[model samples]
Target: MKTKPLYLNDCYIHQFQADITEIGDDFIVLNETYFYSRGGGQPGDTGDIAGIVITDTKRDGDGKILHYFEGDCNLSSGQSVQCHIDWPRRYAHMRIHSASHIVEYFLFRHSDNQKFLSSFISGGKETSTYEVTAAITPEIVEKIQHDANAFIKGNHDILLYPDENNPDYRYCKIGDIVYPCGGTHPKNTSEIGEISIKVKGQAALGKQKIVTTLMP
Candidate 1:
């Protein structure tokens, strides 16, 4: 059975109702899910499914997605379940995801440089880190932080087009500035609030590591 990925279409969906299709030794498969399976640098979503603490989620080959519970719960195949997500954590990820794109856009625009890659959400709790491929000099970090804030302050539009051929495609703009993306983002830059960046120095000879965050 195909697992419906609800979060992909709506990041704000914190709860959903689904039916259990199969149960495995290590995980449970759902007919549909709001829980994000670990992938795309972003971590999998966590929450509760029918009073069961969903500790982690992952996808396997053959297109089957699994939801791993922290402890055993009385769940049976064909049974109905209500899945709820940890919104605070998911929201943080949403912001970081958007902020990462903003950083990438600015880095490309200002540096007039391309080919630099690598981006993901790292670190954890009270201090999540958004890492991107770019040297994190103090000056550059400051500039990126400033630019990201400015963009947020401008309250630019964040539009999501589900039928744009590429389901992951996203567009953001401030006046005339526009760019394409394929990850979850806030409805507007203002939703991002405050942002900061720290360069982890050059990863290799020329590769760099940049860590970003939303100020708490």
Candidate 2:
């Protein structure tokens, strides 16, 4: 059975009730879920289901979200359960995830080259990073950092919508850049706070890793 991913539209939803559709040895699948599965460089959310603690979450082969507890859930397939997500943790992820995009938008606009070789990021409990591909230049880094911070301070609402003409594309339009992503994000750019970028100086010949992170 397919599970409905609620975080797609309402990233702030933390508590809900759902019926268990399938029960496995150590995991359970709900008909609907607010918990975010691991993807897009963001880690999966950990929370509680009823009284049972959820250890990890993953998406199955058929796109079903499986909430895995450390041990057996001991629940039936048709059982009803209450889900309580860790909002603080989820919100932090949303902020950092949005910060990454804002940073990328600045780089994409400022830099002369648009082909990014490779990038990576981690929005953990304490901190987050938005690693992008760019050359290690003092001027480039400074400009991107300044622009990203300005955009964040502008408090623009990050609009999340589908491509009406091209229905297959889901767009999260932030400032001038439109990203096709399904990850969680804050309602506005100000919620992402300040973004800082740094050139790692280690990448392909025409590429570099620009680390965009939160400061204070």
Candidate 3:
């Protein structure tokens, strides 16, 4: 059975209750889940289900969300489970993911429409990096950072909604700028807090990589 992804509509859901539809050696598939699977540069969510610690969340080839945990699960199919996600880690990712979008906007505007090739948020939760198709200079980086900070301080509200053309696809809109994304993010730009951006070296001869981190 296809599992409903609750987080697609609400990113702030830290805990939820669901029924187990399937069970494996170390993983369980829920009827519905708020846990985010590892994809689009964001790491999978780790949490606990009925006090059993979930170490990772992923989707199988058939599109079933597999919630993996350590140790033997004394649970069985059709059992009701109380799920709690690692809120701190999930929140950190939410902030960083939003920051990357802000930085990308500024970078594109200042750097001749430099395109993002890929992005990754570390499992360690220390930094989020985005690789672009073109080189990023020190001056460009400085300008992007300044513009991003000003944008954040403006306190723009964020909206995530389904694209009119495709309900399966989603858009992340911060103020006037809209980006196609499916990652979790805070409701407002100001919630991201202060961020620090730095160049993280090149991924290839022509690609530039930059890292963004949240400031304490």
Candidate 4:
């Protein structure tokens, strides 16, 4: 069965109950799950299920959310399990994901309509990256950082909801800017705190990789 993704609707849900539908050698597919499967530049979630350590969560080619766990697996299908996601880690991703959007918003305002090519959230809260189609000189990166921080400091409310026309799709709106996004995010910009940004490197022949991190 395709796992019902609970995280899409509520980013703050750290714990949930799910029924195991399928069990693999090291992974289990749930009838529903709160785990955010790895995709769209965000890393997979890791936590625990019935005292078992879930090493990672990912979607299979068949569209099942596979909860991969460490050590032995004695669980059976149709078994109900209590699950708990590592809140700090998931919250960190939310902050970084939201901060990345803020950075992209300002980057667009300064980069002369440069395209946001791609992005990635590392496993840790320390860093995330955005790939753009422009050279993105140091001056522009600095300007974007300043503006992004200003926007974060404004503590603007962020809303994530399904598209009016397509419930399967999602959008993230902060202030007056709206972005097409499906990743998790904090409820307010203030939760992201301050962020530091810099040019990481070239991701492709013509794409520049910019890195952003939550500031101390």
TM-score: model 3 vs. ground truth: 0.92
Residues 1-216 of candidate 1: C-alpha lDDT, one tens digit per residue: 878767667768888899999987758899988787876567787888888887788888866789887556689999998889888887887777777777766766665433645456753212223334444467766887788788878877666555468664555443355655444556777887788777664534555566777887
The lDDT of model 4 is: 0.83
Highest lDDT against the true fold, candidate: 3
lDDT of 4 by residue, 1-216 (tens): 888888988889989998999998899899988899997788889999998899899998787999998779888899999999988888999999888878877877887634555667874343334455557789898999899998898989999899889987889998878988888888999999888888766645556667888876
Highest TM-score: give the candidate number.
3
lDDT per residue for candidate 3 within 128-166, as digits (tens), equals: 344456668788888988899899999999999998889
Candidate 3 local distance difference test against the native? 0.84
Per model, state how many residue pairs clash: 1, 0, 0, 0
Q: In candidate 2, what are the lDDT values of residues 1-216, reduced to their tens digit? A: 989888877888899999999988888899999999987667788899887888778898897999989865667888889999988778878888888777777776777554554444454322222233445477877988888888889888887787889853678878766888777888888788876667764435544566666666
Q: State the local distance difference test value for candidate 1.
A: 0.70
Alpha-carbon error at 203 in model 2, in Å? 4.5
Clashes of 4: 0
Query: How much lDDT does each candidate structure score?
Result: 0.70, 0.76, 0.84, 0.83
- lDDT winner between 2 and 3, please give it: 3
**Which run of 10 residues does model 3 get worst, by summed lDDT?**
123-132
Which segments of candidate 2 are over 4 A away from where they belong? 117-120, 124-134, 165-168, 203-207
